[model samples]
Target chain A: MVINVKNLVKRYGDLIALDHFNLEVQEGEILGLLGPNGSGKTTAINCILSLLKYDKGTIEIFDQPMSPDAYDIKRDVGIVMQNVAVFEELTVYENIDYFCGLYIADRQTRKKRVAEAIDFVGLNDFIKFFPKKLSGGLLRRLNIACGIAHQPKLIILDEPTVAVDPQSRNNILEGIQKLNRQGATIIYTSHYMEEVEQIASRIAIMDKGKIIAMGTNEELKKKIKSGEHINLELLNPEDLDLEAIKALPHIISAELTDHQLVVKSGRDKNNLIAILDHLKDQNIAIGKIYSEPPTLNDVFLEITGKELRD
Target chain B: MQVYKAFFRIIQKNRSQIAIYLVVFMVLALLLTNAYTPPQDTDFTKTRFNIAFINEDGDSELVDGLKTYLGENANLVDLPDDPQQLQDALFFRQVVYILRVPKGFTAAMLNGQEVQLEKTIVPDSPSNIYMDLLINKYLNSAQTYFAYLPGLSQDQLVDYLKVDLAEETAVTVISGSSHSANAEKSGYYFNYISYSLFAILILGVCSVMLVFNDTDLKRRNLCSPIRSATMNFQMILGNLSFAVLTWLVLISASFVMYGSYMFTTNGLLLLLNSFIFTLAALSISYLIGNLVKSRGAMSAVANVFALGTSFLSGVFVPQELLGANVLTIASFTPTYWYVKANNEIANAVSFNAGNLQSIFTSMVLVLAFGVAVLGVTLVLIKQRRVEA
Candidate 1:
C-alpha cells in the first residue's frame, strides 16, 4: 500500500468536514474518489497530505508519519488540484522546472522529465508562456504538466478536466491513463461518473464526510439490480410497441421521449431482447441499437441520492 | 541560498522605483539645509545692508555736511529722496534709519524752537536700537542742536514708509517669521518613509499578495514537495534585502546632498539625529503593513500615520509656533523626536546628552512598535492562507 488514511476526523468549529474517513491506495491502482460538492473529498486530501491539521487522524504514507519535513515520502506524490497553481512570475517552463526540481536531483534527468511532461499535456508550444497569458484550458494543461513533471509514484488529480475543451479533456484523460500505465498509483477525484468508470480501477463514492461505498466498476455496478441497457434510435415508435414493451414481466420502468423509449428492468435487464422480439412480432423495426453494461453512475445513484451537484 | 535567490528576484522587479527613492531623498536633502557657516558666527559679509544717512536738515546749511557723510559710507543706499522716500527705504529694510528735518528745523533749533528726527522698525528687528546709537554718536559729534527735540510721531516719523510704519512692519514681521519658522521647522517625513520600507521588508511586498493568490488551484504547488514555511522565509529575505538597499541608498544620498555638513565636527551629531528619524520611518511602515488586512486599509493607515506624524512631529510646521497644547502629546511621537533631534542639531542650540537620549528612546519605541506589528502579521498570516 502506498497511501493509508485511517480514522481521520476533521472539524471546522461546529461542522465536521471529515469523519473517520478510511482509505488505502494500492501500489499501481488508479483509485477515483467520486463525490458531490462539499463531500469531504478536499478535506480528506488536505488531511492526508498534512496540509490541514485534522482533529483526530493518523495519515501514514509509505508506512510512516507525514509532516512538512517528510521529504522522502512527499517526493513521490504529485497533486493536480481542481484549481490551477503556479507562480505568476514564473513562465510555464519555469514553473514546471521549479516543481520538478523539488524532487529530481539530476538536472539532465529533471530537464527530460519536464520536457516530456509538457509534451504529454500538449503544452510544448506554451512552455514559454506565463499562467496569466494562457487560456483556461491551456492553463489547466500547464497545471497538469507542473504536477506530473516530477513524475512521482502517486499522482492525485482533483477534477482536472472541469470546464476544459473536448480535445484537451481527451488529452488529459489519456495522459492520466499513461501515467498509471507507467506503474504510478493514482488517486483521482471528479464529479463526472462516466470518466471515473472509464479510468478508475477502484472507485470510492463519498458523501457528507465519509466514503459510503468503494469497489471496482464492475463490482459497484453489480450492487445495482439493473444489468444491461439497449438504447434504441427510433423516430415515432408506435404506442402499441411502447405498451407491449411495458407489459413485459421483467420491466421495472420505461421512459419515452424524443422518438425513443428506454425500458429499464431488474438484474437481467435484457428485457431489451424480449421487447425487440415483441416489436418484430408486431412487424416493427428499430433504427440504431446500442447495448451497454451498467455504468458507475448507476452504481453511484443506487448507493446515494441522485443529486448531481452540491 | 534559496532565500537569497528569492530576495534577488524581488529586488529585480522594484529596481526602478528604488532608484527614484534614492533620488528623492538626495534632492530633498540638498534643498533643505546646505547653509554651512556655523549658523551662529555669521560673518557679517553676508549682511546686505547698513545704516546712516546724515539727514541733518533740508536747510542749505546742512546739505554739504550730509553729502560729505554720505560719501563715506559704502553700505548706504544713497538718500537723495524726500522725507517720505527716505523713510520708505528704511521701512523696506533697505537702510536701517534716516534723519529727517522739519522745515526751518535749523532755524528752530538755532532759535531753540525745536527739531525732530525719524526712525522706523519692528522692535525685534532692532533697527531703532542701532539708529539710537548712531544718532547719539552723530549728535555728540555734530553739536547738540537737536538734543532735546521730541521724536517724530511713530507714523509721521517714518511717513516715507509705504502704508505707514506700523502698517508695513506688522505684515512684514508676520510673513518673515512664518517663513523662517517653516524653513527651519523639524520634519519626520524621512523617518516615516524609512519605517514604511521596514514593513515592505518583513512582509516582502513582491510576494505578499502572490502567496495569497496561489492558495487555490486545488492541490497545485502547495501540494508540491517544498514546504510553505521555507517559501515564506525566502520571501521575507527578499523583501528585507530590498528595504535595506532602499535605506542605504536613501540615507547615503541624503547625506551626500543636504547632510554633507554633518561632516563638520557636528556632522556625526546630525547623522545620529537623522538615524533616529530613519528608524522611526521603518518602524511605522512595518506596523501599518502588518496590522491592516487589505491594501486599502494598509495604505489608509500608512497615510494617516506618515502624514499625521510628519505634521504632528512638526516636520512641515514648527511645533513651537504652531502653539498647540496637543504638541506635548505629539512630541511623544517617534517622528516628533526624529525631527526634533535634527532641528536641535542643525540649530546653534546646545545639544544636551539628555535630549539625545530621549530622542533615541523614542526611536527605540518606534522600533518596538514595528516589531509588535511584525509579530501580529506573523500571527495573522501564520497558517499560510489568505489573511482574513
Candidate 2:
C-alpha cells in the first residue's frame, strides 16, 4: 500500500475534525475522497500528511510511520493544497524551481524537472509571468506544477479545481491521469461529484468526520436501492393500464403524472425493453422516451435522505 | 539552505523600503549638519552695527579718530533728523543698534572730568546695550592712554592711541579631543540615525515576514521535510543580513561625511553603539510581525513604534530640554540607552577603562532588550505551533 491510515482522530476545541478515519491507497490508483463542504476530507488528508497533530491513531506512508521530520517519506509525497500557495513575487519558473529544489538537490536535475513540470501543465508560455499577472486558471495550474515538479511517488490534491473554468478543469483532470499512469498514487478530494466520478478509480464518501461509505462507482451504486430510471411520455395516457406497468419485472417503483410514465428499476436490471414491450402490447402511443443511470447524488440521497450539497 | 536563499530573495525584491530609508537618512544627515551652528563659533567680522554719527563740535583730531573707529566698527547711516524714521528703521529690523557722539566730547575727555556720551537707542534691546558697553570701553582705553603717556599735544595723543593693542596681546589655544566640536556634532547626527534605522528595520523585516507567514504558504512549508527550527534559523539569518545591510549603508554615509573626525576610538564606539541598536530594532520588528495580521496593520505598528520611540527617547528633541519625568520614562526604551552611550563616547577625553565600561554596559543593556523581545517571540511562536 502506498498510503494507510488507521483509527485517526483529531479535534479542534469542541469540534471533532476527524474521528476514527481509516483509509488505504494502493499504488497507481486515483482515490477520490468525496464529501460535502465540511465533511472532514481535508482534515483526513492533513492528518495523513502529518501536518496536523492527531489526537489518536496511526498514519503510515509506504508502510512507515509518518512524521513531520520524515524526510525520506516526505521526499516522495507531494501536496497541492486547496488554495494557491505560490509566492506572489516569484515567476512561474522560479516558483517551480524553488519547490522542486526542496526535494532534489542536484542543480542540473532540478532544472530539468522544473522544465518538465512547466511543460506538463502546459505553462511554458507563462514561465516568466508572476502569479498576480496570471488568470485564476493559469495560477491554479502553476500551483499544481510547483507541487508535482519533483515527481513524487504519492501525491495529495485537496480541491484542486474548486473554482476553475471548464477547459482548465478538464486539463487538470487529464494531468492527474497522466501522473497516475507514470506510477504515482494520487489522493484527490473534491465536493464535485462528476469530476470525482470521472477520474477516481475508487471512491470514498465521508461525512461528519467519518468514512460513511467506500467502494468503486458500481459498488457504491449497489449500496443504494436506486438504479436506472426510465421515462416515457404517452400521447393518450387516459387509457393506459398503469397497474400492469407497475407489476413489470425488476420495477421498484412506478408513477404517472401529466401524461408521463416514470419507472425506476433495481440494480443491474434492464427494465427499459420490458417496459416498451408492455407499452407496445397495450398499443400505447409514446411521444418521448428517456433513460438515466443512478448518479452519486442518488446514492447519497438514498443513503442519507439529504441533498449532498445541502 | 534553499529556505534561507528564498528568504533572502524576498528581502532583495523589496528595494523600495531600503531606498527610502537611505535617501531619508542621507538627506537629514546632510541638512542637519549644514544647518547646525556650533555654540563656540565666533567670527565677529561679519557683524556691523548701524549708527548715526553727529559731530556738532568743530573738527578735532580726537573727534576724527573717534569717527574713524566708529566707522570701522559700525555702518554709519545718515538720518533725516526725524524721530519716526529712526523708530521705523529699528522696528523693521533695518538696524540692530544705533549710537551718537555728543558735542564737546573731545574737550571733556582732555580735562579728564566725568563726562558722558549721550546715546539714542531702543529700550529692553540687548544688542543696543552691548553697543553702549563697547563705546564706553573704547573711550576709557583712550583716556587712560592719554593720562599716562606724555604727548606733544592732544593731536599726538590721538595718534598714539591709534596703535593696535589687541594684536600685541593675542594668545593661541588648542582643544582636546573631548572638546572637538566636530566630534560632538557628529554624535548629534545619530539622533536621526535611530529614527532611520528603526524605520528601515521595521518595514524591511515586516515585508519579509508577510511572505513567510502567508497562510497557504506557511502550510505548504510546514508540510515540507524541513524542520521548523531550521526554517526559523534561516529566517533569522535573513533578518540579520538585512539589518547588517542597513547598518552598513548608514554607517558608510556617516563616515564619508565626517571621516576626518570619525577615524578614532570614539568613532568605533559610536559605530558599535549603532550596531547594537540595530539588533534591538530588529527584535522589535520580529515582535511586531508576530502580533500584526495584515500588511496595513504592520505599517501602522511600524510608524507608531518608530516615530513614537523617537519622540519619547529624545531623537526628536534634546534630552536636556525634556522633562525629568519624560526622561525617567525614556530610560526604559532601547533608544534612550543607545543615545546615552553615544553621548558618553562623544564626550570621552581618553579611552579609559571606566569610560569603556560605561559604554559597554549601555550596549549590553540595548542587546538585552533584543534578547528579551526575541525570547517572547519564540515563546509565542512555540505556543502557536503547539496549538496548530
Candidate 3:
C-alpha cells in the first residue's frame, strides 16, 4: 500500500467533520474517492495529507510517518487545492517554475521538468500571460500543471475538473489516464459519476465521513438491487393483459407511462421471451426498444439514501 | 510556476483594492491643503497700531498736528474717553499697541517743548514682536526729523516729521511687505505639516492594506506545501515594497509643491525617512492586520485603527496643541516617531550623531514592530495548519 489512513476522527468546536474514516490506496491503482458536498471528502484528504490535525488516527504515506519536517515524504507529494492558488503578479511560466522548484532542486532538471509540464498541459501559448487573463478551462489546467509539475509517484486530485469546458475535461481525463499508465498511483475525487465511470478502476462511495461501499465497477454494480432496464413503446392494451404481463417470469416490476412499457429484471434477464410472447398475443404495437445495464450512479443512489445532505 | 502564478494572482486580486487606495489618496491630497494654509483669523503678522490723541488744549493745533504726524502712520482711534479702557484693550489682544497722549501732550509739541507720550503694550502676546519692530522704526524716524530740524523752519520740521515719520513709514512698510511674496512668518512650520500629513496617509494606506491582505491569505497558503515562513517573508517584502512606492509618490508630490531647491537638498533625507516610515507602516499594518480573521473585517479594523493613529500622532494637527497627555500617548505610535524624525532631519542646520540618533529611533521602533508581527504570523500559521 502506498497510503494508509486508519480510524481518523476530527471535530470543529461542537461539530464533527470526520468520524472514524479509514481508507487505503495500493500502488498503481486509481481509487475514485466519491462523495457529495461536505461528506468529509476534503476532511479525509486533509487528515491524510497532515494539513489538518485529527483527534485520533494513524496516517502513513509510503509506510512512513508524516510531519512538518518530513521532507522525505513531502518532497514527493503534490497538492492542487479546490481554489485557484496562484500569485497574480507572476505569469503562467513562472507559476509552474515555482512549484517545480519546491522539489527537483537541480536547476537544469527543474527547468526541463517545468517545460515538460507546460508542454504536458499544452499551455505554451499562455506561458507569458498572467493568471487573470486565463479562462476557467485554462485556470483549471494551470492548477493541474502546478500540482504535477513535480511529478510525484502518488497523486491526489480534488475535483480537478470542476467548472471546466468539455474539451478541457476530456484532455484532463486523457492526461490522468496517461499518467497512470506511466505507473503512478492516483486518487481521484469528484461528484460527477460519469467521469468516475469513464476513468476509475475501483469506486468508494463516501457519506457522513465514512466509506459506505467499496468494490470494482462490476462488483459494485452486482451489490445493488437495480438491474438492466428494458423499455418499449406499446399501443393500447386491455387492463386484463397487464395481469398477464405481471405473470412473466424474472420480471421484478412493470410500469406504463405514455404508452411505453418499462420492466426491471434480474442480472441474467434473458427470460424476457415470456413477456414478449404475452405482448405479441395481445397484438401490442411496438415502436422502439432499448435497454441499459446498471451504472455507478445506480450503485450510489441505492447505497446512499435519497435524502439531501450538507 | 507556482511562485510566479502566486505573485500574478495576488496582483490581479489586489487591483480593486488599489483603485480604492488611490481614490482615498486623491481625497487626502485635496483635503490636506487645509493644514498648510494660514488660519484666517486676522492680519496678526502686520504691525497694527492704535493711536489715541488727547486734545485737552483749547487750540487743537498740537493734537491736530500730532495726528498728522503719528495718526497717519498708525490706525488712529479717537483718543479713547477713558485711557484705562484703551490699555485694557491692548492687554486683551484687541489692539497691537496703544498710544496715549497726556492732556498737555499736543500743547507741549506746539510750544516746542519735548512731548512725551505713553504707549501701552502687552508683552506676552505674539503681536508684541511686530509691535516692537514698528516702535523701533517709529523711534528712528522721529530722531531723524529732530536732527534735521536745525536746517529747516518749525513749519517745515512738522511737515517733514508728518511726511517721513507717519505717512512715509506707512507707505514703506506696507509696500515692502507687498513687494515680495507676503510670506507670513507665523505658523511657518505648517507647510511641513501638509507634506507630513500626505506622507502619513501613504504609509497608513499601503501598510495597513498590505499587512491585512497577507495575513488573510496566509490562512489559505498555510495548508499548501509552501512553508509559512516563505509566505510571511514574501508578504512582508511585498508590503514593504508597496509602502516604499507610496512614500516615494507622496514625497514627490510634496516636493513639487515645495519646489526645486527642496527636491535637491532634502530628497535623500526624504528617501531615508521612507525606511523609517515603512518600518512604522509595516509594524502598524501587521498589528492591525492580525487583529482580525476575515478580510472584510480586517479592512474596517485597519482603517479605523490607522485613522486613529494618524489623529493621535499629530498627522493633521500639532501634538503640542493636542496637549502633553496626547503626545505621551502618541509616542507609542510609530507614525509619531517617524514624523518627529522627519521634522528634526529637514530642519537641522547640520547633521550630527544627535540628529542621526533621533531619526534612527523611529527606524528601531519600526523594526521591533516588524519582528513582532513576523513572529506572531509564523506561530499562527503553524497553529492553524494543525487546527485545520
Candidate 4:
C-alpha cells in the first residue's frame, strides 16, 4: 500500500470527528473518498497527513509511520486543501516556485518543474498574475499547481473541484488522471459523486466518521440489491399486469402509477426481457421504455437508506 | 533559508508604507531644526546697545564718570532733540536706553546732598535694563567710595571704583564638547525618528505577520515539510533584517542631514542608545504582531501601542514636564527607558566610564523590557500551539 491508515480515532470535545477511521490507497490509483459535508473525510485526511493529533491508530505512508517531523514521508506527499491556499502577495509563478523549492532545492530542476506544473494546470497565461487577480477556477488551479509542482509520489486532494465551473471541473479531473498516469498515487475526496465515479478507480463511502463501504463501483453496486431500473409507459395496464410483472424472474418489485409501469430488479438480473414477454402475452402495448443502471447514488441510498446528498 | 528569503520578499513589498514613515520623519526633522534656536555664546558677547545720553548737568567729575560709564556700556548717540524721534529710535530698537543727568550745578555732590539721576528706557527691553543697572552701580559706588576716602579726589575715587567693578570673573561653562549643540539637536531629531521607527516597525512587521498568519496560508505552510522552528526562525531573521535596515536608513539620513559630527564620542553614544531602542522596538512590534489578528487589528495596535508609547515616553512631552503619575506609568514601558537613555546621552558632559555605565544600564532596562515582552509572546505562541 502506498498509504495505509488503521483504526484512527479523533475527537473534538464531545463530538467524535473520526471514530475508528481506516483507509488505504494503493499505488498509482485514484482512491476517491466520498461523503457528505460533515463526514470524517477531511478529519481522516488530516490524520493521515499527520496534520492533526489522533487519539489512536497508525498512519503510514510508504510503510513508514507518519508524523509532523516525518520529513522523508512528507517530502513524498502533496496536498491540495479544500480551501484555496495560495499566497495573495506572490504571483502564480512565484507561489509555485516557493512551495516547490521547499521540497526540490535545486534551482534549475525546480524552475523546470514549476514550468511543467504551470503547463499542467493550464495556467501558462496567468503565471505572472497574483492569486487575488485570478478567477475562482483559476485560483483553484493555482492551488493545485502549488501543491503538486514538486511531483510528490502520493497526492491528496480535498474537494479540489468544489465551486468550480463545469469546464474547470473536467479539466481538474483530467489533470488528476494525468497525474495518476505519471505514477502518483492520489487520494481524492469530494461530495460530488459523479466526479468521483468518473475518475476514481476505487471508491470509499464515508458517513459519520467511518468508511461505511469501500469497493470498486461494480463491487459496491453488488453490495446493494439494486440493479437496473426500468420505467415503461403502458397503453393498457392493470393490477393483474402489475402482479404478473412483479412475479417475473429477478424482478424485486413492479408498480404502475398514472399509466406508467416502474420495475426494480436485483443485481446482475435482466428483468426487461422477462417483463416484456409477460406483457406481450397479456396483449399490453408499451408507449415508451427507459432503463437506468444502478448508479453510485443507488448503491449509497440502498446501503445508507438516505439520499447520497443527505 | 528559503522561508527567510520569502519572508523578506513579502516585507519588502510594503516599501510604500515604510517610505511614508521615513518621509514624515525627514519632514519633522527639518521643521524641528528650524523651530528651535539654541542661545549662542556670541549673542551675549557681541552686545553693544545704542543709547541716547542727555547731559542736563554741566561738567562735574561725578557726572563725567557717569557719562563715561554709560559710554563704555553702550554707543552714546546724541539724545534726539524731538520726543517723537526719541520714541521712534526706542521703538525701532536703535537705542535701547535714554538717560538724563539732572542739573545739580556741580554743587550737590560737593556738599553731599541727595540726588537722583532720571532714567528713561523702552519698557521690558533687556538691554535697557542691563545698561541701567551698570550706570547705577558706577555712580553709587563712586559716591560711597568718596564718602569714605575723605582724602582722595573725585577722579581717584572713580578710578578705584572702576577697577573694582570690572564685571569680568572666572566663569567657565563646559558644554560637554564643541559639538554638544549638534548632538543635542540630533537627539531632538531622533525623538521624531524614534516615533517614526516605532510606527514603521509596528505597521510593517504587523502587515507581514498578518499575511503569514493568514488561515489558509498558515495551514498550507504547516502541511509543508519544513519544520515549524525553522519557519519561525526565518520569520525572526526577516523581521530583524527589516528593523536593522530601517535603523541604518534613519541613522544614515541623520548623518547626512546633521553632518559627520554625529561620529563623535557622545554622538556615538547617542547613536548606540537609539540603536538599542530600535532592538526594543522590534520586539515590541513582534509582540504586537503576535497579538493582532488582522490588518484592522494591526492598525489599531500600531496606533495605540506606537502613538501611546511615544506620548508617555517623552517623545511628545519632556520627561521633566510630565506629571509624576504619568512618569510612574511610563516607567512600565520600554520607550520610557529608551527616551531616558537618549536624554542622558544628549546631555552627557563626557563619555566617561560612569556615563557609559549609565547609558548601558538604561539600554539594558529597555532590552529587558523587550525580552520580557517577547517571553510572554513566546509563551502565548507555545500555548496556542496546542490548537495547531
Candidate 5:
C-alpha cells in the first residue's frame, strides 16, 4: 500500500469532521475521493498528510507511520492545496523554483525540474509574470506547478480544478494522467463526479465523513438497482399510457412530461428495444430517442436518496 | 535556506517603500541639524551702557578723575545741558543714564559735606543698576579718603580712588567636555532615528512575515519535507540580517554626516543606544506581524505604534519639554528608554563609571523590553501552532 489510513476520527468541538474514516491507496493507481462540499475529504487528506491532529487514527505511508516530523515520509509526498498558495511577490519561475528547492537541495536538479513543471503546466510564456498578473486559470496552473515541481513519489491534489475554466480544467486533468504514467501514485479529491469518473481508476464515494461505497465504475454501478435510462421525445405523449410502459419487461419506472417520455429499467438487455416497441404499439410518434447508462449519480441516489451534487 | 532567500526577495520587492522612509528621515535629520545653532562660548561678559556726563562743576581734579573712571565702563555721549535733549536720549534708548555734577561738588566733598549728583535714567533698565554700583564705588572711596586722610589733596584722593577701583576678581567655568556643536547635531539626528527605525522595521519585517504566515502558504510549507526547526531558524536569520542591515545603513549615514565626531566617546555611546533600540523595534515588528491579519492592519499598527511612541517619548519633542505625565506613560515603551539614553549620551562630559551608569541602565532597560516582547511573540506563536 502506498497510503493506509485506518480508523481515523477527527472532531471540531461538538461537530465530527471525520468519523472512523478508513482508506488504503495501492501503489501506482489514481484513487479518486468523491464527495460534495464539507464531506470530510479535505479533513481526511489533512489527517493523512499529518498536517492536522486527528482525535484517533493511524496513518502509514510507505509502511512508515506519518507524523508532522516525518521528514523521510514527507519527502516522497507532494500536496497541492484547495486554495492557490503561491507567493504573490514571486514570479512563476521563482515560485516553482522556491517550492522545488524545498525538496531538492541540489541547484542543478532543481532548475531542470522547475523548467519541466513550467512546461508541463504550459506556463513557459508567462514564466516572468507575477501571480496577480495572471488570469484565474493561469494562477491555478501555477499553483499546481509549484506542488508537482519537486516530483515526489506520491502526489495529492485537493480540488485542484475548482473554479477553473473548462480549457484549463482539461489541461490539468490530462496532466494528472501523465504524472501517473510517470510512476507517481496520485490521490485526487473533488465533488465533480464526472471528473472522478473520467480519470479515476478506483472511486470512493464519501458522505458525512465516511465512505458510503468504494469500487470501480462498473462494480459500483452493479450495487444499485438502477441500470439505464431511455429518454424519448414523443409527438403525442398525452396519448401514451405510463402504466403500460412501466409494465414492460425489465422496466422499473416510467414518466411523461410535455412531449417527452422517460423510462428507467433494471439490469436487463434489450430494455431500450422493449420501450421502443411499446411506444410504437401505443401509436405515440417518437421524435428523438437516446439511452444513458447508470451513472455515479444513480448509484449515489439509490444508496443515499440524495443527488450526487446536493 | 529557501525560506531565508525568499525573505530577502520579499524585502527587495519592498525596497522602494523602504527607500522613501530613508529619504524622508534623512531630510528630517538634516533639517533638524541645520535649524539649530549651539552656543559657542558659555562665558560671562560685562555690559557697557551709553550715558551722557554733563560735568557742570568743570575741569576740577576730582571731576576729571570721575570722568576718566566713567569712560572706562560707560560710553560718555556728548549732549548739551538741555533737559529735553537728555530726556529724549533716555526715552529713545540712545543713552540709559545722564549724570549732572552740581557746582563746587569737589569742594563740598573736601569739606566732608554729603552732596548728591543729579541723575536721569531709563526706568527698569537692568544695566542701570551696574552703573549705579560703579558710581557709588568711586564716590564712597573719594569721601572716605577725604575724611580719614585729611592731609591728602583732591588730586591724591582721585588717584587713590582710581587705583583702588581698578582691582578685579577672576572667574572660570569648569566642564569635563567641550559640548561641541557636532555633539548636539548628532544627538538630534540619533533621537530622530527612533521614529524612522520603528516605522521602517515594522513595515518591512511585518510585511514579509505576513506573507510567510499566510494560512495557505503556511500549510503548504508545513507539508514540505523541511523540518519546522530549520524553517524557524532560517526565518530568524533572515529577520536578524534585515535588522542589522538597516542599522548599518543608518549608522553609516550618521558617520557620513558627523565625520570624526561619530568616533568620539559620546558618539559611540549614541551608536550603542541606537543599536539596542533597533533590536527593540525588531521585536515590536515581530509582535505586530503575529497579531495583525492583513496588510491594511499592518500599516495602521505601524503608524500608530511608531508615531504614537515617538510623540509620547522624545523623538519629535525633547523629553525635557514634554509633560511629566506623558513621560510617565512613555516609560513603558522602549523608545522612551532609548531617547533617554540618547539624551544622557549627548550631555555626558566624561566617560567615567559615574557618568555612564545612567546611560547603560537605560540601554539595559531597552534591551529588557526587546527580550520581553520577543518572549511574548514566542508564546503567541506557540499558542497559534497548538491551535492549528
Candidate 6:
C-alpha cells in the first residue's frame, strides 16, 4: 500500500469530521474520493498527510507511521489544496522555483524541474506574470504546477478543478492523468461523479464522513439494483397500459409521459427485450428507442437513498 | 534558505516605500540640524550703555570720584539739568541710565551718614540691572573705607576707592566647537530615527511576515518536506537580517552627516540604543503581522503604532518639553526609553561610570521590551498552533 489510513477519527468540538475513516491506496493507481461538500474528504486527507491533529487513529505511508515530523514520508508526498496557494508577489516561474527548491536543494535540477512544471501547465508564455495578473483557470494551473514541480511519489489533489472553466478543467484533468502515468500513486477527491468516473480506476463513495461504498466503476454499479434505463417513444400512447409494464419481470418502475414510455429495470440483461416484446404484442408502435446505462449517480442514489449532488 | 531568500525578495519589492521614509527622515534631520546649530564665531565683547551724570551737590572730591567711575562703564552724555530734557533723554533711549548726586555736601558721607543718590533710568532695560550693580559696588566700597579708616582724608578715601575698584577679575569664554554641534545634531538624528526605524520595520517586516503567515501559504508550507523548526529559523534569520540592515543604513547615514562625532563614546552609545530599539520594533512588527489579517489593517497598525509612539515619546518633541503626565504614559513605549538614552548621551559631559549608568539602564529597558514582546509573540504563535 502507498497510503493506509486505519480507523481514523477526527472531531472539531462536538462535530465529528471523520468517524472511523479507513482507506488504503495501492501503488500506481488513482483512488478517487467522491463525495458532496463536507463529506470528510478533506479532513481525511489532512489526517493522512499529518497536517491535522486527529482525535483518534493512525496513518501509515509507505509502511511507515505518518506524523507531522515525518520528513522522509513527507518528502515523497505532494499536495494541491482546494484553494489556490501561491505567492502573489512572485511570478509564475519564481513561484514554481521557490516551491521546487524546498525539496530539491540542487540548484540546477530545481531549475530544470521548474521549467518543466511551467511547460506542463502551459504557463511558459506567462512565466513572468504574477498570480494576480492571471485568469482564474491560469491561477489554478499555477497552483498545481507549484505542488507537482517537485515530482513526489504520491500526489494528493483536493478539488483541484473547483470553479475552473471547461477548457482549463480538461487541461487539468489530462495533466493529472499524465502525472499518474509517470508512476506516481495519486488520491484524487472531488464531488463531481463524472470526473471520478472518467479517470478514477477505483472509486470510494463518501457520505457523513464515512465511505459508504468502495469499488471499481463496474463493481460499484453492480452493488446497486439499478441496471439500465429504457425509454421508448410511443406513437399510440393512449393504448399503452402502464400497470402492465410495471408488472413485467425485472421492471422496477414504469411511467408514461408525453407519449414516451420510460421504464427502469433491475440488474437483468433481458429487461429491454422483454419490454419491447410487450410493446409489440400490444401493437403499440414505437417511434424511437433509447437505452442508457446506470451512472455513478444511480449507484449513489441506490446506496445512499439520495442524489450524489445532494 | 528558500524562505530566507523569499523574505528579502519581498523586502526588495517594497524598497520604494522604504526609500521614501529614509529620504524624508534624512531631509528632516538635516533641516533640524541647520535650524538649531549656533554660529561658528565665539568672540566676547562687553556691552556699553549711554548715561547722564548730574551733579546736584557742589564740586567735591567724592562727587568727582563717582563721576569718573560711572564714566568708565558708560558713555557719559551731556544733558541739561532741566527735568523735561532728562525725561526725554531717558525716553528716547539716548541715555539708558542717569545718576544725580544730591546736595548733601561732603560731610554727610565723611560722618558715616547714610545718604542716598537719586537716579532715573529706562524701566525694564537689561542694562539697568548692570548699571545698578556697578553703582552699588562703588558706593558700598567707599562707605566701608570711610567708616573703617576715619583717619584718611576725602582725597585719600576717594583715591583708595578708585584703586580698589580698578582691580578686575579675569573672565574666559569657552568657544563652542564642531564636536558638540555634531553631537547635538547626532542626537536629533538618532531621536528622529525612532520614527523611521519603527515605520520601516513595521511596514517591511510585517509585510513580508504577513505573506508567510497567510493561512493557505502556511498550510502549503507545512505540507512541504521542510522541517518546521528549520522554516521558523529561516524566518527569524530573515527578520533579524532585515532589521540589522536597516539599523546599519541609518547608522551609516549618521556617520555621513555628522562625521567624527559618530565615533565618539556618546555617539557609540546612541548607536547601541538605536540598535536595541530596532530589535524592539521588529518584535512589535512581528506581533502586528501575526495579529492583522489584511494589508489595509497592516498599514493602519504601522501608522498608529509608529506615529503614535513617536508623538507620545520624544521623537518629534523633546522629552524635557513633554508634559509630566504625557511622559508618564510614554514611559511604557520603547521609543521613550530610546529617545531618553539618546538625550542622555548627547548631554553627557564625561564618559564616567556614573554618567553611563542611566544611559545603559535606558538601553536595557529598550532591550527588555524586545525580549518581552518576543515572549508574547511566541506564546501567541503557540496558542494559534494549538487552535489550528
Using lDDT, give the best candidate's number.
Answer: 5
Query: Chain A vs. true chain A, TM-score per candidate?
Result: 0.89, 0.90, 0.90, 0.90, 0.97, 0.93
Q: Candidate 1 lDDT (Cα, whole model)? A: 0.63
User: What TM-score, computed on C-alpha atoms, does each candidate reach?
Assistant: 0.70, 0.78, 0.68, 0.80, 0.83, 0.83
RMSD of each: 10.6, 8.6, 8.3, 7.8, 6.6, 5.7
* Number of the candidate with higher lDDT, 1 or 4: 4
DockQ values for all predictions?
0.21, 0.37, 0.18, 0.38, 0.50, 0.49
DockQ, candidate no. 3: 0.18
Worst 10 residues of 3 chain A by lDDT: A301-310
Q: Write the per-residue lDDT of candidate 2 for residues B1-388, one digit (tens) a residue.
A: 7777787777778887668767977798778865775566333233577777666667778777777776776788877656698778777766666555567877777777777766677668776766776677668778788778735476676666677522333444455332477677778887678888888888888888888788788778777776678777888888888899888988887777777667788887888899999999999998887777788987788788888888888876878788999989998999988988888887887888898998899899999999999999888866555225
Judge candidate 4 against the unseen true structure and give its global Cα lDDT, from 0 to 1: 0.83
Per-residue alpha-carbon lDDT of candidate 5 for residues B35-77, written as tens digits (9 for 90 to 100) = 9777666575667889999988876898889888999998889
By summed lDDT, the worst window of 10 consecutive residues in model 5 chain A runs over: A267-276
Better of 4 and 6 by DockQ: 6
Q: List runs of model 5 lying over 4 Å from the truth.
A: B39-43, B47-179, B386-388
Candidate number 5, chain A TM-score = 0.97
Per-residue lDDT of model 4, residues B33-88, tens digit only: 55766555532253788888887777677678777877876789985567798888
Model 1 Cα shift for residue A235 (angstroms): 3.4
Off by over 4 Å in 6: A233-240, A255-262, A280-288, B28-172
Model 1 off-target regions past 4 Å?
A: A13-15, A67-72, A101-116, A119-122, A241-244, A282-285, A307-310, B1-207, B210-214, B217-229, B262-305, B319-334, B348-356, B383-388
True interface contacts retained by model 5: 0.67
Interface RMSD of 6: 1.7
Worst 10 residues of 1 chain A by lDDT: A235-244
Compared with the true structure, the alpha-carbon lDDT of candidate 2 equals 0.84
Q: Who wins the DockQ comparison?
A: 5
How far is B335's C-alpha from truth in model 1 (Å)? 3.5
Sorted on lDDT, best first, the list reads 5, 6, 2, 4, 3, 1
Better of 3 and 6 by lDDT: 6
